[model samples]
Target chain A: MSTSKFVRQGFPLWLLAGLLTACTTTTVDEFRQGETGIESHEAIVILGRRQGSTYETREEFVNCVGERVSRGSGAIRVIPEKEFVDSLFPWFEPRTAPLRTSDLQALMEEQVVADKIEEYGVRYIVWVDGQTETTNRTGSISCAVGPGGGGCFGFGSWEDDSNFDARVWDVSSFANVGTISTDATGQSYVPAVVVPIPLIARVEANACSSLATQLQQFVNGD
Target chain B: MFAVTGNRKTTATRSLRVLAVLGMLALLSACGASSLVVEGSYPTPAVRKIPLSLGLYLDENLRNFLYIEYTETGAEEYRVSSGQTHVQMFSNLLPAMFERVQVLESMDDAAAAGVDAVFAPSIEEFQLALPQKTRLDSYEVWVKYNMRLLGPDGAYIADWVLTSYGKTPMEGLLSVEGGINEATVSALRDLASNFTLSFGAVPEVRDWLASRQNVVSNQ
Candidate 1:
């Protein structure tokens, strides 16, 4: 191959390589930053996450909260998803958009008064929400030259990130109880990459425990 | 030609190598790429108790269902379908399942009748698993009852047929002697205990409320 030919071909390859490297590092840093902003809380109301027919994610959160509460100082009661659905009718249902502060306040007042009269001892209620994202990319090439300059080449990369955000509302008076968010992101240069299992697990467990602690404080009026 | 060909091959090979690495990385990243994120908040726990009042005759029946096995049939089936001979057996049994609360308050017929609300026990279904004749005719019964508490404001509380079951002796003279009678009673008692633990008023709450009232009186 002539020097000019090599330079022409190599320059783009070098640029692509630099871009790939930058993208990889940038994604990793983004993940780390995403992981950092997670806020902590003492108490939280967990809502249901559904896919077709399964609410596995929501169930997991419930279990996580239950375990954390069981280990902590205050009492914890899990409101069944059915009850949450019922609450939505009067508070979240009629609304055309995401809940407004006034709507939440109204819910708080109604629930608190009704609960106090019916349950007498109930002191608070909590709620939560979550979201996730994924992406993939690939490239390939093959070529052959007998007596001429000919060769085929191909390249590709894929990346994915998952995030979770949670918010809490006080049931007694519809106040913002607390909020938290956690994220786990990873990328692969190969056909496949091992997800950061340890990282996801750590963040989920930590966030749950942190929320439990916040709930304890709320109950304590701290 | 050789040098040019060699350089071309090297460049191609390097590019392919990078692609292969990227593909593998993609697969690896996607491999368990799925995540489970959970957020939960606690709700104020609700505590309520519905009293059972059917006079002494029904109360005794409830006690019997809690302690003894009658024949090889389960209490839920036997009691529910005993027909007119039993009349409203569940009405008799609902109060019995709540023996703990009644025991604590000594709520007699007069007190129950005067209460602001009452829950009528409704039967949903009764299932019986009986032992094969060779196995001594032992059988298990599962009974589901739906109950609704009516106040001046209409239905105030409801519980679906929470199931309870008992096993009884299937054969010999034991079946004739009512081997299941004891089992049915025990099963009923166990069911009652579980229900109370889950939804009944906390005993401590009652005590606290009483003490507060006493303090006010003292003041």
Candidate 2:
């Protein structure tokens, strides 16, 4: 069977996989330990962004990775985007590309920012950006309700794929350390009886976990 | 009645334990608040001795033993007076490394002491960076010094500035003050060692000391 046809046929099984895997499996495509040589056990910020929409998506992914980086990896601290941006760029807020290496260098030159960095001993900044979308959809669902009796039922399936890249930068040296990329793909199903029951594949969550793990590994020289 | 007596014993035991814990915490805090005096001396290096009067221009801040209290607002005003400054520490360290070194309080003292040359050392900067839970696993301390070698006639011989850093891993359960002081001691030790090595190794200093020795011999 063609790959697309097979994926369409395996919608139920994919939903089952989603139910079984509390955290979807993560696949890492690229993990380059950059040359900055920053210590792993230092505070690093995780930021997320996308070309369209606001910073909501970035915040969600940053929270996810920040939690895992602190808990799973032996990282001394993982700074979330909210804290990083709120403290550093309180007035102007854009996670993806507003701040560059030169901008950071200039900030570091400021006495206040320099003092803060020295106090916290921050080492690295990890910038994450990506998109997760429904790649394919198949089957159909329908529902109907009458005044005497109300009933609705439908069955449908869709495939979701998440792609994200994380770039690590050293705070002191103001240099890029490395990059980590992750791709997570899963199929979901929706069964509508009286109400719609959707089994959603945790594509974003899987990508976050994988990217965080790889970033930690890259920093710790693992 | 027996049950009541047993309960009373248990209550007494628990109370005693709580008291002991509180006492220990109190003791820890008291000790943590105290300033640290650097103890011990580095072994004199194997080198020719230079007889000179050393003038110490100690910064007022370095005169007090300093420690840090890791707080939300960062470390502030935790200093203790120990009757000695970092200059005095250097004074204590120099006698061992040099053949004959006299601590001169002023240029007048150097002139009266009939010393060929004088060395003036001043603290440029001092910082004790305490470790934080989410930020750092190691404590680091930094010290910078601006030094000048001058003749008793108030003529400058040479000038040099040196910055040294020391770091140590944060270990055990103790007060932030204690941890920072330990790291500071390490940094001071390294700074002293570097100073001694540089003092003897610098070409200009070596020549100057050698010339002073030759002048003394001729006289």
Best-matching candidate per DockQ: 1
Per-prediction TM-score of chain B? 0.39, 0.68
Off by over 4 Å in 1: A1-44, A48-75, A83-98, A108-113, A116-122, A136-160, A187-222, B1-219
TM-score of candidate 1 to 2 decimals: 0.28
Q: lDDT (CA) for every model shown?
A: 0.41, 0.66
All candidates: DockQ? 0.02, 0.01
lDDT of 1 by residue, A1-222 (tens): 897997877667756454543121111111111111111232233453332221124446655665565455555544444455333322222111135446555434554335532342333344444423336655543446668666445444455443444455454454554554445444545321222111111334444555556544444454
lDDT of 2 by residue, A13-95 (tens): 85766575433456897646455445545687777653343222445677888888888536648766655553543211332
Docking quality level of the chain pair in candidate 2: incorrect
